[model samples]
Target: MSFTLHKKEKLKSKKLIEQLFAEGKSVSNYPVKLIYLKTVHDDGSKIKTGVTASKRNFKSAVNRNRIKRLMRECYRLNKPLIFNNIVGDYAFMFLYLGKDMPTYEHLEATFKLLFKKLIIKENHEKLN
Candidate 1:
């Protein structure tokens, strides 16, 4: 799979976003938390993802935007972990949960751990 995160791969539906928070399960590694929901999409994409940084924590649009950019970049690079390992289409939201600014290295490491945890959790669920 390509390493680019295409427009269709972005999660933009208001209804879907609401439902995701309502029914989605989450995996977290410190400053990063991934919330995911299994669902079909009309676009036939394997996954649709969104990233956010809390305004309360960030306090500035620039900081929040920077955090969000780093989150998306990390997800874009590491998404194959989910696409190759998981079997179904999913909607995902990555939330920044820390009170301080984050470095790219920190986010990348957290993302890898978070995705691994998600994979393990999904595999365990399937086995049950």
Candidate 2:
């Protein structure tokens, strides 16, 4: 498992992200909320993900963009754990719920923790 950051792993479509938000089940664990839906594709070889920071919290576009960029970077670095652990494909939307912007260390730790929780959820489901 080479943790290569690839273009296909990025979730870029607004419509798809919104659809996932509308149809997906969410899990919240303070400061971060995850909205995920199982997706089917003939080429189900990779996972795609998106991140958002609420305007209601940061009113400034600069702040929101900065938060989103940080979240993406954190996810990019941490997501290979999920890719290696899960057996199948999934589409994930992560929303930042904190009132203040987090430092890189905080974001990275939270991202890894969330991914680990997700892997545990996936494993638990498989055992059922």
Candidate 3:
């Protein structure tokens, strides 16, 4: 894979988010929630993603923004692993669930674990 930002896709639209939340499966191990669904877009190579930090967890915009930044950075760095497993165009949302932000190491390790689990979960779901 190129691992270029040019191939990075954006997941927009309220309906898509809601559908992913309602119908897709979530993998959570504290501090992070991965919600994903295989979406049929015209372009199968696109992998659209969205990041969110709940306002309920952190009222301050700075805190929320910080968490989002961390999530995006981790995703940008580690997305190749995810891209490899995706069968087609997909939409994903990463939500921060921790009360306080963790260190980069903590986030990176946890994010890696989460993605690994997600790949397993996706395979399990596909068989059913």
Candidate 4:
């Protein structure tokens, strides 16, 4: 798969987002949390992902947007971890859980760790 995150790969449907929150499971690595659900999409994409920064933590929209941008970039770079190993389509929401602003390096590390944990969790679930 390509490193680029195309428009179709983005999680945009309001209905899907609600269902994800209601039925999804989560894997968290410190300031980053991945909320995911196994579901098929009509678009045929293997993963549909979204990133969010809490407004309660970051009051300014600028800071929130910056954090989200960093999260998206980190996920875009590290997403192959999920795509290559997982067998089915899933929806993911990456949530920023810390109160402080994070640097790219920190977020990147967190993203890698979080995805690794997610893979392990998924595999373990499959075995049961």
Measure candidate 1: CA RMSD.
Answer: 0.6
Angstrom error of the Cα, residue 118, model 4: value is 0.5
Give per-candidate clash totals.
0, 0, 0, 0
Per-candidate Cα lDDT values, in order, are 0.93, 0.81, 0.83, 0.94
lDDT of 3: 0.83
Q: Could you give me the TM-score of model 2 versus the true structure?
A: 0.86
Worst 10 residues of 3 by lDDT: 1-10
Error of 3 at 100 (Å): 0.9
lDDT of 1 by residue, 57-88 (tens): 87899999999999999998988888899998
TM-score for candidate 3, please give it: 0.89
Q: CA lDDT of 122 in candidate 2?
A: 73
- TM-score per prediction, in order, is 0.98, 0.86, 0.89, 0.98
Clashing pairs in 1: none
Per-residue error for 78 in candidate 2, Å, reads: 1.0
Clashes of 4: 0
Name the 10 consecutive residues with the lowest summed lDDT in model 2: 38-47
For lDDT, candidate 1 versus 2, the one ahead is 1
Evaluate model 4: give its TM-score: 0.98
**Candidate 2 per-residue lDDT over residues 56-120, each given as its tens digit:** 99999999999888888888777778877887667888899999988888888888888888888
Model 4: how far is 37 from its true place, Å? 0.2
